[model samples]
Target chain A: MSKVALLLGSLRRPGNGIGIASWLHPVLREGLNDTSSGTAHTGVDVVFVDPTKPPLPLGPIVDGSHVPADIRDPSKHPNPNVREFATFVTSCNGIVVLSPEYNRGYPGELKNTFDHLYWEWHKKPVLLVTYGSSGGANCSALLRSFLGGPLKMQVAEKAVAIKLPKSHSNGSDKAPTQGPAPDWLEQYRPEVLAAVAEFKDLISQQSSS
Target chain B: MSKVALLLGSLRRPGNGIGIASWLHPVLREGLNDTSSGTAHTGVDVVFVDPTKPPLPLGPIVDGSHVPADIRDPSKHPNPNVREFATFVTSCNGIVVLSPEYNRGYPGELKNTFDHLYWEWHKKPVLLVTYGSSGGANCSALLRSFLGGPLKMQVAEKAVAIKLPKSHSNGSDKAPTQGPAPDWLEQYRPEVLAAVAEFKDLISQQSSS
Candidate 1:
């Protein structure tokens, strides 16, 4: 089975990012599980990684020889969280990041996690799903630049951005009440589902090739 | 006198961001101090605000009734740091953000600071000075979007970006020794100085109007 990691980049629990991801999760599963589809894969495994639950420590400076040896060695890292997170990234064949636009950018927690490891993310097929005031286009653009430039990841061009209605509350204490998604999100659902399916196929083809 | 805040967005002290800011500080002061120029302004006062020190707590949710009264009041907040920071922001006539690019974005500390308050940032003029591997264009772009969109601040078109050589070290402990800036930075100095002067003029014009 192909293992895909769904990385939640929001620090708040009851956030739009998570709300959207909650909806996307099943869509991705169903897309991957459908054997009627012409892909050679039987089923795909999805793992949820929340940056807030097991917070990643700030990473070392990106200097070459100057980076502390312990940080360079994931096994020897002083922080167990970093080690566990690294292991999770290494296990995943593909990665999808669901991020909320905070201050018109991706949350710091997400960037911190990516900064922790370099090679672990290399060559991984990645998809971005974002929702916020401006539909998180800024966050998606920055993520694409980072993933393509420094992290050396293969990023999909077809990303999904849902412009959250002004009424949405991104509070930490409560999850958005589960219900049919808002009308704005509903309009994009088909495109988002297609993107997720295409991302899965891309991951399968890349891994098999 | 016009009060301007120099907000440094890096978590690491004695790092490249601070180093670049150190170089830019005098340039800004000189521009602001040169009263002989035609702008209708007195001397300018510059205050340094570091995001890491007296760190700001995550901001309260923007819900109308849910926002804590203390956070809304700014005076009753339990954390003196947040209160002080709010005051500093409110007192400033204009703001300049000096940030280092980390993971192809601005540091979490900077975003956290911005997240803590809303109205204080509104109507302020923000100039970005960034230094990093990609010259912090990504960070600057995201910051501009945030400041312009939700924050309701005016961002200058001409900003400064310094691309540090690969040989530079951004470790936390040691300050880069005082010396003439690298040749690449030297080449950009004139343009950066011009941008700073233009930013000061813009702030003066806006405040006066």
Candidate 2:
């Protein structure tokens, strides 16, 4: 049984990032549940780490009252939040990241989260579900480079991108009634699933070895 | 009169990004103030675009919020703050961008700002001053690619990058500060001055053309 953690990176609650993830979670759950093993993917646990959460007072950084010493070189910094996040990632077999496209890149909170803990991210299997004007493709691509190069993470090549062109608004939709997701997403779902499955298998094999 | 806008991207006021910019402003002012050649980069103006201003009305997609219609494409979506920023950038002759690196990438707000405006940014001359853990080198490269591909901006090849390692917080009497800048920025004065001068030339040429 492998456990995967889904990290949602965005300040807005009903953002496209979370909305699309909401839609995908059921599919992933159903896929894992229907597996031949008969056992469900209960192992797949998700914890949404919101950046706006109030911090525990370890020092100045957490309180936002003053600059934290750990921020200077976050990779080596020893902060409680960083430790907690790293522990969660290290415990999980895989990760699913959902983030918005800010400016031309990933949101600051996401970067701040990762910056504080680099070692935990090494060699982890991660998938990105990104959305925005350009489907956040540039942001995802830039993020992939950063993770692959410095953080040393094995980022899945097939990212799930929800560009605005495809989004249709439905009054019932969790996302701003944004219309339906694009047809390509449905068409390519199998590929993305297969990739995740393979990645899980690889992680399991490594664990056994 | 060429009006050059310095769009400060970082949220930290007294942080490295603004401090570096402040140090270089005098040099630019000197060049702009030169009386002999009225063409010495006059009509200088600096405006700091705050990233935390407010949410934009993202047209129909954003529901009640005021997102501009042109932000349909993710690549075209300016930062949420850009709805106001576009007006300033379009009216200016050139732009000097001050950015900080987070997790080996541009701060989310900085990227968000660019995501909002589309056509207003085309053909603008951008002088990059990126500072971070490793002097923001990787971020600088990624930014160049982004601006070149989508924004269609003339990104100056010569950028001023201040590696965090080189920063000097304490001024020693033995080693007096050399450049026109204050003591803290003595280490990075050369690159800083060079970038500003180069930016002045780029803007002057573009404004005349």
Candidate 3:
């Protein structure tokens, strides 16, 4: 089965980034097969890589390379999360980063996870879905540069940036809450669909080749 | 006494960021008074805010605002480190962030400390000294926007980006190592001095006013 890692990049529990992703998860899952004309997406499963659930450590390597070089592969790494995470990353066909612009850029927690990780992202297509004060425009540019330049990932040309108006926001990017999809999801559904359509096409190409 | 908080923003103990700060500390301390033409800087003390030393938490409020609102003042916060840290931030004349660029951005541990902070950085003059493969330019721009935007801080006109050559870097920003200064210190001393001169003048004005 083809898999896409939906990365939640907000440090906050109920952050708008998570909220948007929460709303879009089902749509993406159901919509993957909805495309009648585009590249055939077969079993394109959308999986979440939420930072808070197990909470990826603040640093790249948990023990900072205390593990012997021989044992540093995916299975034997000292940290269970990193071990599992590396394997999970390689198993995926594509990625979707749902992030919030903290300050003027993306959250460090998100960037921290990708540090020291070189090959896991190789040739994988990425779709950035950002939410913040500036609709996450500034963050989108920086993340694109970093991911494409060093991580060697292919970022989809189309992306979504949801600028939550101050009046509507409850403020914090909280952990995923249980409820119906957030209200704003309907407004941006079309843009997200476009981005995901582009994303799936890229993923389809990667899988075949 | 004019105090400047020299922030070591790298997670690695002997990281390049710490190395540069260590080399620059004594120079900045002694040279703060070396100025003859610019604003008078007296007793300019350069203090190190090394993340690994005490290791600021991976967050702003240690309890994440678990404490009641009334006791949230700098003096009464539940977390001793944060209480003291907030007070320390307020006591400073200016701030110097000595950071290494990680994947085109600043470290999250450093940014996490300032997440909900508002008053501490108000009108504070900040000089960013960045070290990275890109000579720290990309990280510099993102940080400048963040500090100048939500944090309400002033980014100094003169900043330094020391791009350590890959051949020279031991491949990581390790914690500040013991012993004689690293060899590259001498090469960058003059540029370092110029940046500090501008930094000290800003501090001097902030102190005098």
Query: On residues B10-116, what C-alpha lDDT tens digit does candidate 1 reach at each position?
Result: 65543566666667777677766766653545678887765545533433222222333215555544446666777777778888898877666766657766766
Q: What is the two-chain DockQ of model 1? A: 0.27
lDDT string, candidate 2, A1-209, tens digits? 56666676665544455556655665555444445432324455444444455331111112211233323343334555655555666777777787767556675556655655556777777777777757788778877888777788778777777655443221222353245644644554675566556555545554565
Those runs of model 2 whose alpha carbons end farther than 4 Å from true positions after fitting are: A1-3, A8-19, A31-42, A47-93, A99-113, A116-124, A130-138, A157-183, A202-209, B12-15, B35-39, B48-83, B164-184, B187-194, B205-209
Q: Indicate the residue-level lDDT of B1 in model 1.
A: 72
User: TM-score of each candidate?
Assistant: 0.78, 0.69, 0.85
Best by lDDT: 3
Model 3 steric clash total: 19
lDDT for each residue of candidate 1 in A1-209, tens digit (9 for 90 to 100): 68888897775534565667777777677766766653545578877765545534444323332332225455554446666777777778889888876666766667756766777777888988887767888889888988877788888778988777766644333324378755666688677766766676778777888
Compared with the real two-chain complex, what DockQ does model 2 have? 0.23
Q: DockQ of candidates 1 onward, in order?
A: 0.27, 0.23, 0.34
Candidate 2 residue-wise lDDT, B20-84, digit = tens: 66655665556555544434655576554444443322211222132333343433433444444
Better of 1 and 3 by TM-score: 3
Ranking of all candidate structures by their DockQ, best first: 3, 1, 2
Whichever of 1 and 2 has more DockQ, that candidate is 1
